[model samples]
Target: MTKITYVTTHGERIDTEAENGATVMETAIMNAVPGIVAECGGACTCATCHVYIDDAWRETVGGPSSMEEDMLDFAFDVKDSSRLSCQIKVRDALDGLVVHVPSRQG
Candidate 1:
């Protein structure tokens, strides 16, 4: 399992464990982590699961793909570190990943 941390807009922090192969959004939804509505599930067709990766984990988490980038256009408060949580698969290498949720979804 991988450990993922979610920092909310209100400065609340939530830590959860994700099964290897699950997506970041899935981990959030399963753990009832707020700020990730996942309206379209993990399809990456929507930006409801958008998150900003912590600077320290940016390179490891990497950037959004073309499709994910297109979808991010519909998200709120997108930044250089913005990413679609649903597009990020959980893996051992992703343990300790930290992401920040926006104040609101699009």
Candidate 2:
């Protein structure tokens, strides 16, 4: 399992373990982590699962794909670090991934 940290807009920091092969959005939904609405489930159709990848892990996490970039246009407060959690798969390399939830969903 990989360890992932999610910082809510309210400043609540939640650390959870995610099974390898699962998407970050899946982990958040499974753990009932607040701030990750995941309205479209794991489909890349909605922007409710928006998150900001921590700067330290940006290189490791990588940027959004062209499709994801298009979807992010509907996300609130999009930033250079913005990403859809559904697009991020859990793996050993991302053991210490950190993501920040925006104050509100788009």
| Per-prediction TM-score | 0.97, 0.97
Considering summed lDDT, which 10 consecutive residues are worst modelled in model 1?
41-50
For model 1 the local lDDT of residue 39 reads 95
| Candidate 1, superposed: residue stretches over 4 Å from native | none
lDDT for 69 in candidate 2 is 97
> Which residue pairs of candidate 2 clash?
none
Residue pairs clashing in model 1 are none
lDDT of 1 by residue, 25-106 (tens): 9999999888899999888888899899999999998889999999999999899999999999999999999999998887
Candidate 2 lDDT for residue 45: 97
